[model samples]
Target: MSPCTLLLIACLGVACPTLAGCDISMERQGKYKTEAPAPLFADGTSAQTPPDDTVAQGALAEEQAAQTPPPATPALLARGRERHDIFCKPCHGVSGEGDGMIVSRGFPRPPSYQDPHVRQATAAHLFDVITHGSGVMFPYAERIPAQDRWAIVAYIRALETTHDLDISGRPSPRTAGGRGS
Candidate 1:
């Protein structure tokens, strides 16, 4: 109410907090935040690349039972097919040829899994793509677990093998202009 009292309140607002060691020093911003510029670093990045042999917590190496998949038994193949149909078939097609329903609906078609280049890619490489995603394709690491990704890779390999088998051993698919079986 009095001018002295009002002046006292104003002074306390600034002085008391500082005296109590509750000033805004902690709230002062860091020189940089995540992914921000860093004049101190030679590379000019706030983040530094991890040294070799450094692994992220709970990474692929730990998640997968083995870097190389186990035997592609019938059960594994079946599960692969199921997972593929659920997550991959929308973009990778039932046969892994990059012509899925989404591709038909104006989405960009992916490279065919049956391509010779794709066939040459290592299983681990395929797993990496599924985990991190390729160009234009989003990652499925969350939707498809590490094991299921292995299964999908196995299934894609199976598709490639089937296409390479002897022509006479299987009923030939009709050409585009020809009738279906």
Candidate 2:
């Protein structure tokens, strides 16, 4: 192309408003404005709301907050037993005596659920504690499934039914030779 013509084209290109810039300015002004109003979220939930029936409800103020009881099916108990044996029994003992192998070593002892305080705790409390854990115990919020946790709690309650121990009831291990060592 001619030098003059090329120079004129380059100048026009530099001076002309870009198609993208024009669209952006148009969007900022009329119905197709770029600064469209933000969508209002119901209950401040960012995602689209699920249908009414599917949502889980929180406990009411007047009602005692308790773990929603699982279906008292044999399957649930069995599952709970299985989970307890696998996860809890290792540290809590088969009888929930809190004298598992780990405790026999150097690990700190866990409390026996047979204690009056443990026995009196509501199901909701157990669920909260198991889900969230306390002290040396780590939260199993992600590790244990919600329903399975309830089952484990049920098994723990069962453990209390058979044992009669207390906060200071842990037996001191006697040395093989009957010495204080």
- lDDT of candidate 1 over 70-109, digit per residue (tens): 7888888888899889988899888787989998799999
Worst ten-residue run, lDDT, model 1?
Answer: 172-181
The clash numbers for all candidates, in the given order, read 0, 4
Off by over 4 Å in 2: 1-67, 164-181
RMSD of 2: 12.7
TM-score versus the correct structure, for each prediction: 0.58, 0.53
**Backbone clashes in model 1, listed as residue pairs:** none
**Residue 147 lDDT in model 1?**
77
Segments in model 1 whose C-alpha atoms lie over 4 Å from true places: 1-68, 166-181
Q: Could you tell me how far off, in angstroms, the CA of residue 119 lies in candidate 2 after the best superposition?
A: 0.7
- How far out, in Å, is residue 106 in model 2? 0.9
- Give me the displacement of residue 87 in model 2, in angstroms: 1.3
Residue-level lDDT of model 2, residues 1-181, one tens digit each, is 9999999999889768665356555446634223434355434434454777663453242122233567667788789899988888878888887888889788899878866677789887888888789778778866777778888888887666434333455433442232221
